[model samples]
Target: MALPESARLEGPILQELLALGGEERLRVLYRRLLAYFPHLDESERDCASARWRTLVQRAGARLVKKGELRREAGRWALTERGRQRAEAEKMLVEPPPEESPRRALSHEELQAMLVEIGRLLGKHAEREHERYDVVWKDSPLSPRLSHVFEVQVHGKLESALAKLKHAYDTQRSKPVLVVSDARDERRAREWLRPYFSGSFHEIG
Candidate 1:
């Protein structure tokens, strides 16, 4: 059974949970909701019950369709517009002022870091080679590729994954996708599972 129709979970409350979690797998978010609303009937809280799950799932889908949330990699996260709404409603939790924010890395810097990592591993690494954003070779003279990286700070996820898939098919190089945030990384991981299968080994 689900919560009473009169006591149904509110959309804003779900958004608040997503904002608080930064990004959360659907199951985890559901569990958090149970904790938040402990007065609900036991039947509604039972994992075996589809009613509660259905309600939550529909609510999440509605938010996604409304452009206020994103469902990626089996996880849900607030979009920029969603965050703004949450903040305006004073539902978002403020971070502690004592902690300083980490500097966001730019696309070029991310590529540079990957190149350095490749070099440290004793492989020759270079940025912006043909269609690939970064690639590693055994040596500058070697024609074979070892690892291929696509740095995606902002752009189509399909485009980046497509290039990696091509590299794997032709060069048999290990494919890696680099993203600025954890959210994108998870999103990439979800997309990789069905399409790339195990061809792509890692996401950083």
Candidate 2:
């Protein structure tokens, strides 16, 4: 039930409703995806997203039937029961599985690749807690390996990039960045090109 990031969405409607604080216009909820993936071609992505409302309605109906939410004035809001349920579920669901680091890796084999890179470059990789996810200092990978590895690791990539830029500047490291697939990498490279003309690599 989770929507793919390439589809300009993140979901399981119940989870989204919870994030919206239990109330949101169906259309507004879908638009959250657009805000994150704004660069997605309208013809391709928007056309696909056009059906989200129907999906939301279908999912929300179940919640409404369970007394978890209420529909009024064409908007949906969480009922007290829903709020309580969401809190109860949060203990089991905080740090969602979809946001895990291995998401970009199509297969388990890639984890070994990341580890090999860290070993070859003499950098340490820690998937959790600390200023950045991975750190490389004074290694040959110095500027290249020194980065906040990309993922939809945060709720919003914009927030993540902001944190990355701040860390990059404050940490007195190299400058030059961004990437995912080739298309996304190109767009990000273009964005960073004016300020940095160094080697840039794309990692899923």
Candidate 3:
């Protein structure tokens, strides 16, 4: 039987998991998707389960005996035949052509682009500052495409305190940053008094 369009997408999706070494990593990938796309209702998301089963069954039939794919633990890897078929399918696929590319810009042109971007950001910051006194800085965490986390620094204690409180209350996790100076840290602790009543540490 011919594979469905969903099955085709699922084949690559499962292959991506297998290439990452199976279920241990796959579960992490799944969770990251959930965290990033919170709009998805897990209970209503039958696509994942259905696609997973279809990919396993179809790919498994061509590679391993019936039931082999479903029986694996820790990692769900592709059988030899499955791997070959996946490779063949990938070879047959082609990406859509690029829409258009603006003429390559010179150094001066690039600098002009940067200036425009900075102006836009400045306008945005001014608008934001009018509504909220909080100022944010980037976190030390390395950006990962697969991670579902956002980290930021707040200039004032109240903003940081509010975020910290919300994180705990919502059962969500986020990293907050405070100044390295002892005096500033003390002040932050005092401001956070109402919301965060527990011990907090400052890391350089």
Q: Output the number of the TM-score-best candidate.
A: 1
- Identify the leading candidate in terms of lDDT: 1
Query: Number of clashes in every candidate structure?
Result: 0, 0, 0
RMSD (Å) per prediction: 16.8, 15.3, 17.6
lDDT of 2 at 49: 56
TM-score ranking of the models: 1, 2, 3
Which of the two, 1 or 3, has more TM-score?
Answer: 1
Query: Model 2: per-residue lDDT, tens digit, 58-112?
Result: 6677778778878887777878887877777655534333433434543223334
What do the candidate models score in CA lDDT, each in turn?
0.72, 0.52, 0.39
TM-score for each of the candidates: 0.46, 0.35, 0.26
Candidate 3 has its poorest 10 consecutive residues by lDDT at 142-151
For candidate 2, what is the total of clashing residue pairs? Answer: 0
| Model 3 lDDT, full chain set | 0.39
**Which residue pairs overlap in candidate 2's backbone?**
none
Clashing pairs in 1: none
